[model samples]
Every structure is written in structure tokens, then in C-alpha cells.
Target: MVASVPHDRVRRPEATACAAAAILAGFSLACGPAAAQQATSQVQLDEIVVEGAGGKGVAPAYAGGQVATGARLGVLGDTDTGKAPFSVTSYTEQFVRDRQARTASEALALDPSVRATQGTNAPFDSLYIRGFPFNEGTSGEFAFDGVYGVAPSFRVFSDYAERIEVLKGPSAAMTGVAPNGGIGGVVNVVPKRAGGDLTRYTVNYGSNARFGGQLDLARRFGANREWGVRFVTSLNDGRTAVDHQKEQAGVGALALDYQGERFRAWAYGVVQTDRFNAPSRPFFMAAGVPVPKAPDGRRNVTQPWEYSDVDDRGGLLRMEYDLTDRVTVFGSAGGSHTGVERYFASAPTVTSAFGTTSTAPQFYGLGVDRQTYEGGIRAKFETGFIRHAVTLQLSRYVEETSREFAAARGSYVSNLYNPVGVPAIAPLRIGSRPRLSDSTLTGLSAADVLSALDDRILLTVGLRRQTIKAHNYLSNVGTFASAYDKSATTPFAGLVVKPWEHVSFYGNYVEGLSRGDIAPATATNAGEILAPYVAKQIEAGVKLDVNGFGGSLAAFQITRPVGELSPARRFSESGEQRVRGLEFTTFGQVTPQLRLLGGATLLDGELTRAAAAANIGHTPIGVPRVQLNLGAEWDLPWIKGLTLNAAVIHTGKQFVDAANTQSLPDWTRLDLGLRYATDIAGRKTTFRANVVNATDAKYWAGAASFGTFTLGAPRTYLVSMSMDL
Candidate 1:
């Protein structure tokens, strides 16, 4: 029997000094703002291996140890990439530290199929995967530990993450409906767990005097080592690469678990806060204006007094029991809350070729609360010549949002190139935020994998019935404005055929779900709720693995529905957007001391149907035609435990408007790094250094599907050291 345990307990960290002091008390590390800015400093500890109902502990790394051999696939549990029909990749904790990634977006930049749509200094993070928006709407699309609503809402730090997994294409049948209706892919974060007795300390420094420190501790108790606990805390504060911008962040996380012969349980909690002065914002293009050249990457037009602050809290509990050798049951409950307060100019609109811009400053406050519950059963058995693996999952997700806003006294004008900063405006008073919207999603899914012929052939089938219910209320008064409830069923079918020991052919047909649209007041069917829209994808691929080298080539097509108004002024889901793409990825050790990781994606997107005839056949906004990334690492034969690496990222031109009248030019960036591993005073230690945008190219990084664009980050340096005790 499994033992009962209380859920996670999380608290907001105090100021930088207090929080650093508290976390550094028992450790032998230094504290304070300047501690990390020194010439030497030490980083995060590795997690202990503990398997839940998922069948195994963390997946093993490939030859180079930068990427994992497999990743979690929602209700399907942990799956090897070579055996799974879908395309997925998981970056290991080693990769995160080697790159010195401060956030999820930084670590994800290496993927050719994904692109960041916001600036590095933006208040929140947003991404586009496979030519579609992932986290662009009111609700986030990230999942923590195979469940939604348990990770930070706005941004995710890598301090407490064991691995970051990306599953390509729509996954409604595999993972359930995404809160934001994202059809591109799913990004999952695996939290760190206790592993081995360890105490580790890390310190880092970034360009412009940014300093940070982290502490990690883990211990296992009991005679059988069934009880484990791990805790991690970190803080970063100082000026940033951008002009007039200062950022501060603090994070604390705790994880506990109990591993028994037949029962297992895990609990996780995390709290984080981020503060920014003169945070960067996206840019918009005025209608009929020609796109202008990008300004210097360090340019900033916001007043120094403008600021933003965000706080996030999350907790999760999971338990599993094995009824028999062939059967297991599992359940999990988790929740997260995000709070935001900011006073700054919204997206600035460029009005002329000379870079003249206009924006209105405002004060905004927002709150989002999310909760998720899931339970599932897995069974494995054989009948005759076929071996079957079956699973059934039931899940529910709920989200609530509230907001308050007030505009400044007047608008401000600035030049993107010259960056004229105006005097700080008086603060706009905002009242208590009222209920804005609430949504509930419920789903039941089942899948079965049938294998025969010594596991050479595998066929999988699955289905999910998903229900979406949402309510919108007027701000302040909290009076109901509108409501909708709808349900739909999505299906999945996949096949994998292995002809040789190291080669496989795979294909899949899957469907995705999105909330239906509400007719506008001008439509004939005003206020009517349409049926939930369904997206379909057909994919086929080939995989190869031999002698520590591996790669995959895949081709797929996705078609999504869009709302449109007919000639009769009746609104309905009658339009469509279609995208066809090809992907090629390679990862592993090419030689004894050389490693390669990168790929390229080719996309062709078109608006198949539209409300306006003039828009037919136009390319979708923000869908680049070509994207490429190539990275390599070489271990110096002359020096032991030393490696050098370099990478290049390039994106093709993209349209900024649905009408195709505005566009942003293509851009390319280069990155370089080096690291050394050695023992310091009998303790294992590593030192790393990196240069981002090494050429200091000034360009437009990317465009949002909504027609906004982000400025590229300037050249910057990063360095860090980690030591284990």
C-alpha cells in the first residue's frame, strides 16, 4: 500500500539579500549581489532516478549525452524516439548547463522546428513550432510532468528542470486539449528529483554585470532508500544587455518522493518572481508603411522608470500502485497561479521608413489560476501471436483569469533608431482586478499498441472525447458576458515497421481539438457557439541508428479550421489553413571526440479558404519558408575534459500581415562556446563560457502570427562554474 503524504508547500521568496542569505546559510557558498560576479563560481546537481507508473526512470542519454534516447508521451508514458511514430526530442540537463540557458526559450533555440516570437527581454515567453503559435493566447500551453497547469505560466527557468521535451505536431489525442488551442506541438518540463547524497553550488555571470547563484541539495533516507528529498534555490539580478534595462529573478523548488516495491509517490512545489525595469516589448507595423531596417540591438525607447513584476506558484502530487506484474494504476493532481503587474508602453507601431513610432503607456494587472487532475490505468499482456499494451486516461483542466487596466495621461512618440526616451509619466491607479474569463476542459482517452513478429511491427490506435466549457464576464462588475459548452472526439492511428535492428519506418494519422468561435454581434447568428473545430495531420518518417550516430527524416501536412462570415452575414467555421513541411534532424557522436546536433525545416503554408476572396491562397503570417540550425562540438585531443562548440541559426523571410503587404527580412546568427571539466580541491568542477550573436548582427528576429515583430538580441557573453561536494 502507498503511504499518504501532504501536497507541496510553496512560499514567495523574500528580497534578494534575505533570500540569498536564507538559502546560503547551511551551505559553504558565498552570498550577496556581487558573489556571482567574481572570476570563479560553482551550478545545479543531477537528479536521482525514481520510476513512477511510467515504467522507467529518466530515459538514458544518447552517445554524446546531450539529448535523451526517449521522452514522456502523455498517457502513453515514456517512449523511445526510434520506436515512437511521432517526432519528439528531449534536451538533457547537461545541454541546459552547457548552453547557460536562463529560460526555456533559450534552451529551445537549438530546435530547427521552433522559433521564439518575442525578444529575449520580453516580460513573458512565446514560441512558434512547426509554423504555428504555441503559447500566444490567454492561457499557456506548457505541461509539467505529463500534466498541464503545473508549470510557471509566463516563463520557465531551467534551474529545477531535469529535462525539456518537445513533441511535434498536434497531440490532442495523446495529451488532451491544450488550454490555448495550440496545434503546433507540446512542450513538457520534467522536474528534478532526489538522486544520490549531494550538495552542489553554482555561480554565473552574464554581460552587463548580471550576477546569479544557485544551491542544490539532495538526500535519501530509510534502510531501503525509499524516501528522497531535493531542494533547489537561485537568484539573478543586475543590468542586462539592453540599454536602460535591469532584470531580477528568484526561484525556489522542492521535490519529495517515496519509491516502494509496489507503490510510488512524488510531490513537487516551486515559487518564482521576476522584476524588470524598462523591459523590451514587441513592435507593430503601421498599415501602408514600408518595413524599415532594424535598429541597433541595444536600442531602448522605454523610460527607465517603466517596470514590470511577475510572480508564479505551483504544486503537484502524483501516486501510482502496481496491482499486478502486468497492470498499474496512477493519478495526479496539480495547480498553478500567476500574478502580473506592469506599467509600460504597449507594442509600438512603426509609422514611417525613418522608424518613427507611437505608443500609449498604461498600467495593467492580471491574475491566472489553473488546476489539472488526471488518472489512468496501464496494462500489458499477450494473446496468441500479438502482444498488446493498453492505456486509459481521464483528465480535467480548469482555468480562471482576472485583469485590471488604466491608461496613462497621453501617448508618446519615439524613434526606433535614435531611441528618444520621454520623461516617466504619472502612475495610473488601477482598481481590484475582476473576473475576466473561466474555462474547463474534460477528456477521456484510451489507446492500444499491438505488436507481433518479435516486435518488428507495431500498430497503435487511440481516441479521446473532449469537452470544452468556458464563460466570459464583464470586468469590475463581474456580470456574465457570454458562455459556451461544446464537445468533440479526436482519433489517432500510428504504425511502425522495423525491417532491420537499427532502422524503422513510421507513419501516423492524428486529430487535434480547439474551442469553437463565438459569433460577433454583426453576424446573422450573433452570440451563437459553433461546434469545436478539428485539425488533422498525416505524417510519415524514417529513422536510422547505427554505431552511436542517429538521424530522422519526416514529412507531414496539417489543416486547421478558421471562422468565417458568409455573404448572408452568417458566421461559421468555414475557412481553413493548411501547412505542409519536411523535417530532417541528426543527433549523436559522429566520431570519438566529435558530436553533432541540428536540422532544417522546410514549410509551405497557404490559406485554403477565407471570408474575403482577395485573401485566398495567401501565405499564413509568421510562417517562414525555410529554417535551419547546425551545431557541433569537438573535444580537444590535446587537453583532457575540454570541449569547443559553435552553432549557426537562420530563418527565411516572413510575412507580417495576412494580406501579405508587410514583411520582415530574413536573419542569421552565430554562437560560440567552450568548457573545461576538472577536479578542484578534490571536488568535481566545470567552467563554461559562451558568446551569443557573436557577430552582433542587428535584425528582426521573428514575427508573431498577430502581425507583430521582435527585435534581435545584441551580442552578449555568459560564464558559469559548478562544483559538487
Candidate 2:
């Protein structure tokens, strides 16, 4: 069950003079003539003729062209009103296009608090925000076009998006149950749809031997402008710098929209497929031995047969109706199906000096098939003194996983004891290897956003209830088994104050709960199941709109109880973890020709309690302390239709294990882009070139286990051309 808070009824006077002044300031910067004329008139100076200006102009005339837009920073729209509160950061489409970002990870690099790992493995390439790992297995909340889509594995293409939004902290009221909710934040991808023009087409190529294109076409009809259709498609193929690795992908989408006086409808569908080669898992060498490197000084250990493949399909339908002038009703439903298959080599053996070797049997095959369905509805209305918005959502998710492998049933193998001089022996073929697991999540939630105090202050609150059911079909015959059922309620709250038209201050609190399903140690009775895990968060931030310059700053804290896992007992509750951090970002146009955008973040994460004496008070895995991003674009007036841009990313050292026994070093990378746009045969065309890791810096991006590290990519270049018709 869920409840919504009542709206507050109050009124306040508007800021008349302040609004006028702000508008005037904006006009002066946007149009120089008006500002100059006002200045000259005040000075009582004679009318002065200006070049490129009409008679009686006071200021010199200059070519007026489109100004570059900067990134969007500040709070997120889906923030909870009362519980687990936090700030949000957004990057607009204009920023992404100006930077010419090639991937989602690259697009997020504009934020100072976000650290990205660009390893060869697709599953490992992820983002760490405010000391939280937000990636595939441990995904935070994610939304598509402002709608909640609760699937961990969502395939997105940068070419099809208009912008990306990063919401900091827990937001269970807006989002829902997830694997890890305490530490990380949510990222929402906003798609591009019909606007203005009726049709457009673009094609691009990369120097890495990859080519792709997209087509967007729209049509308008009817007297009331009630019908529209949009279509998009893309494809690409390329090889990575890693040894023997290749990647291929294809994507397509279609959308239809209908608009009437009181009713609106939207239908959309998408399909994506990817095939790629997998890289080797990293490992450490013995003490005093030289670290082995590939022919080019990079780590190389990938097996020739390792590979990964994925297929995804999804669709959505949404409808809205304006019941009256101040009342509206809206509903949305969506579904997705995903399939994955992978074959990878595993290095389960390690060497120690104390005459002991540790090893586990290597597995070569794993597969997963997942299906999800989500639906929601909401109504909004405004009264004499209060505005009210309410939302109700229901979701159902299901996932099935299968694993097959051959195991060794003998003593641990040692590097020196290999009589055949091979590091790993061939795995014997077993009669049959089978393992299967299934999980289902059902949830319901209701929320409201209220405007009170004469619209000067806003209040939002919500509650959510969820049930998780799990079953392990192969529990009686393998090392993995689980069966569990549980339920929990999450609450959220937030407050926003608009002291002035250009400034807003907000704070939030939110909570999240996830069911704990334990793995079986033996092929026997049902595995032990523990209570649901809960995470809490709090955050406060401020947003400033200074005419054309926008900026935001926020501070947050998150806490969660730790659950330990082992082969004997599965989970032992013993520790508490907390993450605290601050994030700041600035965007918008600094000048007409030169645009600058950047952000920075500082965070500290620690474990307050642990079973191991040395593990207590240590930093968690993959959390960095300091992250920074800086980007600038210059439009060269001397060279018509030419622009130059540069971006830099810096990340501090990070721990790789929960105990903080091992760590990855700090790293920095630079990227550059050049673009030229002109009219050819009466059509708009653009030529672009990009250089990533321009300095060819060799650095470690991530680590899987003790002493195992993944290297970043070397310098790479991409050249592309696009034409609009």
C-alpha cells in the first residue's frame, strides 16, 4: 500500500523587480545593440554609426550566429520528497553533440564526480558515482524518456539520445527495488523524438574500421495537427585494441504519436543486437617477479575461444488525457526481452610463497534470458491555492540464468608441478552439466509532487511496496540453489524552495530494500534465506541560473548494513558501510563563441564494522575519492564553419577489494575533436575527426580480484562525415 501527502495552501508575492533585472541582463548579453544604445543614451552622446548596423545604431555590428550550449547541471526531476534524498546532474543534447561523444560512458565523463572504467570487457566497463558502483550487476535506478524501466541490462546507443540525466542518491519512491541501492545513484537516458522538422538522415564512419548511420523521419497531418510518425535505425562494426577482439552491432526503432484537443497517445518499439570477442581476466604475478606485458607493453592473456553475444528487443505505449483545464491523466506500459551467451577463460589459480597454491575449476559457458514488464498511471490537477500531482505504478520482472561447466576433482594444481609445462590442464568432458535459476519481482508504488506556499515551495512524498520470489530448479544437483519470498516497504520525501526566479534550493531523503537470496552449499535441502537489505540516503543541493551561466552544488551521505557470503553459512550480518560525498557542476554559455563546461566530486566511503580486524574502517571496492572533468569548445570565426574542442578527465586512486588490501593507481586521459560544417549541393554536411586518449597514456582502469588489473585503451582516432537531407 502507498499514500500521498496533502498539498500545502499558501501564497506569496512574486519578485517583480528581480525578474525584470534578470531579463534585462540576459537581453544585454544576447543582443549587443540594445545594451550599447542604452549606454550611449545615458551618456548623452551623439548618435554614432556602427558597421553592419542600421542608421542610429550606437555599437559596432558583428556577425550574429548560433551560440554554443553547455551541459545541464543540478538536481534531478525524480527526487524523493522525504526519504533517501540527493542531488541530480544532467547533460543536454547540445553538450553531447558539441563533444561528439561516442558512447554512454564517454558522455557521462563530463561530470567531475563520475569515474569511468574503459576495459575490454563489456560487463566491466561502467561508471562509479559518488563512491557507488553503478553498472550491470549492481545497477542503480534507470529511466528512459522520464519513465521507469527496471532492467539491469538495457542496451543504449548514443546516436539515438537527446541527453542523459544522473540522479545522485537513493530514490526508491521514484525508482524501485534494485540489487545495490545504498551507495550508488541513478542514470536516466532521454531519447530524441519528433520536433520541428519532419525528416532527417545522417551517416557516419570511424577510423577504427567502423561505419554507422541513422535516419529520423516525421510527418504531420490532420486539421488539429493530431498525427505524427518517427523512425530511427543504426548499425556498426569494429575491432578493439585488445588482441583478437571484434565487435558488431545493429539497432532500429519506430514511434507513432497522436495528439487531439484532450487526448495524446505514443507508441514506440526498438531492437538491438551485439556480437563481440571477450578479453582475458587479469591476474597478478609472484613477488619479486617482473610484471608480464604484451608485445605493446599492455597486459595480454585473453583465450582465443572467448566471446560474448547479446540480443535485445523492447516496446512502450503511453497515453495522456486532459480531463479539464487543471486536471490531467496519464498512463504508460512497456516490455523488454533480453538474451545473452558467453564463453570465457577463467584463471582460478594463484601462487603463494608459503608452499600453498589456491585454485578452482575453470568454467567456459554461461547464458541468461530475461523478460520484464512495467506499467504505471498518474493524475495531476491544480486547485485555487495548491497544485497536486499523483502517480501509481506496477511492475513485474523475471529473469532466468543457466550455467554449464566441467570441474576438476583433485588437489589444487601448481604452476611448478605442471609436468606438461602448461599453466592449465585440459578440462575433462562430463556426462552432463546443468544449472538453472529464476527470479521474479512484483512491485507497486504511489507518489505525489505538491506545490504549496503560493508555488514558492514544493513538497514531494511517496511510498512503495514490493514482493520478490525466487526459485532454483537445479538446487538438488549443483553448487548453486536458492528459494525465497519476501516483502518490504520503502518511503521517500523532498522539499524544494524557489527564493528567486533564477535560484532553487532542495533537499531529499529516500530508502531502498532488496530481497536477500542465499546460495546453497550442497545438493540438499532448500538454502537459507535472510531478511531484505535496506539502504538509506540523504542529500541537499542548490541550483543557480545566472542568466546564461548555470551551476549547482550538492552534498550527500548514504549508509547500509553489510552482508557477508561464504560457502558454509552463505550470509553473516556483521558490518555497516557509509558513503559521504560532494558534487559540483557548471554549464551553459560562457561566451558566444567559446563554451565551457565542467564538474568535480570528492567522496569518502568506509566500513564501520567487519568480521576481519583489518577490514573495519576500510574503503569499499571501486570507490574513488576525487574525480574531475573539464571541456571547452571554440568556434573559429576566421575559418567559416569550423570548430575545435578538447576534454580532460582525471580520476584518483581507488580500492579494488572490500578489505582495501589492493588498489588501482590514479589516471588521466585527454580527448580532442575537430568539426566542419558547410552547404554542399544545397544540403547540410558535417565532417568530424576525434582522437581519444590523445597522449597514449597507459593506465589501469579497473581490477577484478587481488592483484588483477585491467588496462585502459591506447590512443585511437575516429573520422566521420554526416549529411542532412
Candidate 3:
């Protein structure tokens, strides 16, 4: 067996501090040394002026740019949200940078329809969208540049992102088949690109001594400035607001691209490493134990010896060629390799309502490698007086995963309100390797859109054939436990009508796909493979745009089968879960000095059918009934370069179990921010500060889809300063 680190001997914290300091010092040298060298140059330098503007994939900064007017649509290319038949929101890079966001969860917290189940400091990133959970250690919910299996499998950060786009509903026709089958929608990230020649540096600090720095450099060369290159790197180290929290992370990315007359192509390479010590995990109360009040959000019960570490590497390439003025062909291929090791007391079995608990944490590790690719062709033509556009695409993905597991010596006793650590616990040695799972997904899709009446009306119809295969093994010492292969077809239709120039009415019927549930070992048909599942959705909405100040109101209903453990102890798909909700959203400027961004969702979710008759009409686990958010950014006329921002997010009470017997109270969170733009010496500079959970409210944030609960984050502060050379 492996020996364990003592409870009092945590990982070296000074090593992380030194690395972070070195990163910041390097950035300082890059900013000052180059200019000093230029001033002292003995030889004249010939700076060749490249002619023509280079291709820039990132959306340009617009007037009062808090949100993007449109987003890149898979196969169909970039689409204007006003003319699209779906509810879509794309947050710009400016919003992310000015808000001083570090992770995807913090950046998306303002969306009314979303709630971070694990709060912001947990090891895993989990969320609920439209009253459903898209969570797991490996969520597979994130898409990079409209492609899956490329982003980090465990979690995603915003260090190298240019923008984030969320398509609000089922999108089998728009994105083909997702690996996780996220019926609610897809969160896609656009990587930064090289454009104008420039170099930027930033220094950041947050609560609990968090400190870091970043370097961003871009350049273009070649005839017509057809070639471009960009590089970005960052490192940060600190303890979080939580007690004894230790965290450190480093990330680097390189982007290269070429924009020719008829051909455009780009590629990206990224690597990241993250580690945590004494990190907090969620609790799972026993069925008979009375639920206890949530403990202080800033307290930590984790053992100092327990930790989680992750290392990830990924690369991607995309190309597009114009076959003709009205037709184009495009293709993209990407892959990622991720390794994770976690040993923590994540399962908290409550022993009493007075805060006593029993814990038995284990060591779990996994490595996964994936390959994904897609290609498509799109063309536009005319049929009589109607204009038509057609697209055909194909995609495939494969992943191989292996894992190892070991248990600690004995259980440790602790309290939820006050904690104690037990010594003499030993760690296990890595004895063997096990082949865990291998999965594959392949799909083909075709779509057509027709427009008429001076482009006032549009109708789109699409279909996709999807196939999925999964293999599960009982470790390397045993035979395969199950092999599942399934196929299905999903179809969708949409209509958009513009009775006036600034008003549009739209409706759609779409479907999502997923691997079906199989019978458990207790069943007679144990190990049986089932067919794929298809979720259906119907939605309608109205959109308004008046000089860039606009919003949308939509109503939608979605239904899908859920897995269940029958009274007989057998597992099957016996419940039909449905969610019906109305969404209200607004964005853009109310005036030149004032901007607004926020929305609200009202949902009614229930189990329409179930083997347990008593649960048939019960509310589904973790589905919040209501959510609201409203934020404003105001440019101070009295202060030429200053802006003030604030937002509020509220989530209604939610059940934690299918029986609806256990529930968490509603929570309200507040955030405030400020920014000032000015010239420092001769370089452009910006100073920003933000505070989340300003009140330090102690509350359970919410529950994940699987009935696990996460405490809301504590009061946190973030500040940063950036300069350009």
C-alpha cells in the first residue's frame, strides 16, 4: 500500500507562489525590455508595412458592446439572432474581460435559466439549464468552435476564449449528435485569433491572496496580411475564500490562421494543468436522516491530504473554401487527451441532524483520449420566386477511457459545522490498470431553408441519422459487462415571420438523441442493450429589435424518458419527465449611457409516468420553479471613463429527491462591478473590480440532477489591470 501524507503536512504552497511570481515578472519584462531595446538601437530597423486588412474571426467590438448581435451556427455558418427561429445569446470577450471572470461558471452566472450546482470553487463544474441538469465529472456539454471532444473533459476556463454562445434548446439538426445528448442546448466557445499587431499584459488578484498574470500577443505577415499568429499564456496561484483552500492553475494556447481570397483556415493548440488541496465537496444525506441546515459557505471539512489534479492537452484545425459566390465547403477536425486523479471525502453521509457525519473517501483516477471530425457543404439557389439554401454535413467521434480505483483504510468521523481530522490513514498503491469504457458517435444531417415575400418569411426543415456504440468492461481482470449499439433519426422544422421591420415571430419543433438505459443486474434481462432515446421539443417565441435595444419572450415544452430503479430493485426507463417553461430575456443598450442584460424563467416540471405510482405526478429532482436576473451597465456622464454595473440572481426552492421529501431553500445572490478606461502614460489601459455574493449569504446554492447538493459561494472580490503596447 502507498503511504499517505500527514494530516498536517499539506502540499508545498510556496512552490506555487514562486511560479505565479515568475509568470508576472516575465510579463513585466516583455512589456518594458522591447521598448527599451528599440530606444537604444544602434542600427536602423526596416518595418515592412503589410498591406490590406487581415481576417479576424472574433466578433469585432461594437458600440457599447456588452453582447454579440449574432453567433456562429454549425454547418449554416454565422447567423443573425433576429432572423433565426431560436433563442440564442452570445456573450462577447469584452464582457468576460471587464467582469474579471476566471471560469465558464462565473461568466455564465448572469443567465436566468442557468444555476451553478457546485457553486464556483468546487472541483467539478455543474449547472442546470431550463430546469434540467447537464452534469457529471465529464459533462461533455462544452463545444469548442461548434465541435465536441476538444475542450477539457473535467472543466473549462475562459483564459483563451474569445466568446461563448448558448443555443437555448434541442439542436440535433443544428449541431448533429452531441456526445452527452444535452437536450437543453449547447455552450460553444470561440478561440481568440490574430488580427492587428499588438501585445497586451494583465495582472490579476482576488480573495485570499490569489494572484496571476497573462500575456497576449498577435501579429500578421505575408502578402495582403494573409497569415496571422497569436499566443496566450497565464498562471495563477492562491487560496480561495473557503477555509484551507489551495488552488493553482496554468494554461497556454497558440492560434495560427490564413485568410486568402477564396480560402480561410485556422488551427489552435492548448495545454492546461490544474490542482487543488483541501478543496470542498458536496454532501449526500441518507434517506432516513433528517436534512440539516447548510453550514457556513466559507468553511471546509476536507482533509488536508485529500486533493484533485488534472492535466489536459488539445488541438483543432478548421478550413473553409468558397466553391462559388453562392456556395461553400467547410471541414474541421480536433481531439483531446485528459488525465485526472482525485482523492477526497466527497460523499458525506449524515449521521444526525445536529451536524455529525461519517465519511469514507476513495482514490479515483482516469485517462481519456478522443478524436472528432466534421465536414459539410452549403449552397443557395432559387426555386421560382422563393430563395432557398441547403446544407449537408457528417460528423464522427470516438473516445477510449481507462481508470483505477482504491479505498482508504477506514472511515473518518467529522462534523458538518465543526470538523476533525483523523490520522494514520494510508493511501493505496497503483496495482493495476483497467479498461473502463469506449464510446463512439457518428451522424449525418441535411437541411433546407426557404425564404420569400421580400425575406419577411422563412421556413426550415432538417433531419439527422445518428448512431451510438458503447463498451463497458469490469476492469482488466474480467470480461466485458455490456456492449450497447443503437441508432435513431431526429427531424426538426422551424418557421420565422417578420410582419414588421423590427418585430419577428418564430416557432420550431426539434428533437434530441441519447443512449438508452439498460436493465440492471437485478433484472431478468440484465446486461440487455436498449435502443436510443429521442426527446421531443416544441417552442414558440417573439423577438424585437429597435436600434440594437431588444429582447425575446419564448414558451417551450420538452419531454424525455428518465431512468428509474423499480420497487423490485431492477433498473429501467420507466418515467416520462416533462418541463414546460416561459423565458423572458433582454440585451443591448437602453440608451447611449445605459445598458441592460438579464432574463427570467418560469418552469413547471413533473414526472408524467413512473413505475412507482406515487411518484407519477411528483416534481422532478433539482428542477427549480422560477429564476430571475437583471443587470445594468451605466457609463458615468459625470466621470468621462468610468462605468458602474450590478446584477441580481434568484432561484426558487427545489426538491433534492424524486419523492419531493427533501428540498433546499430559495437563494438570492448579488454582484457588483466597476471599470475605468484611460491611457496610462502612452499605452491604453483599463482597471476593473468586481464583487460576487457581496452579502456573504450562507445558503445551499442548489441541487444537481443526481440529487447532490452544493453550497453557494462565499463573498468574493476580483480586481485586475490591463495595458497594451
- Collision pairs in model 3: none
Q: What is the lDDT of residue 584 in candidate 1?
A: 92
Q: Distance (Å) between predicted and true CA of 97, model 2?
A: 4.1
- TM for every model, in the order presented, reads 0.92, 0.78, 0.91
Candidate 1 on 120-167: residue-level lDDT in tens?
888788898998888886647888998999899878999888889999
lDDT (CA) for every model shown?
A: 0.86, 0.58, 0.79
lDDT of 3 at 75: 54
Candidate 3 per-residue lDDT, tens place, 502-609, comes to 999999999888788767777766887667767888999999989868889999998988777778867777788899999999888889999889999999999998
What would the per-residue lDDT of candidate 2 be over residues 444-464, giving only the tens digit for each residue?
A: 888777887765688878888
Cα shift from native, residue 227, model 2 (Å): 2.6
| TM-score of model 3 (CA atoms) | 0.91
Off by over 4 Å in 3: 1-55, 59-63, 476-478
How far residue 54's Cα lies from its native spot in candidate 2, in Å, is 38
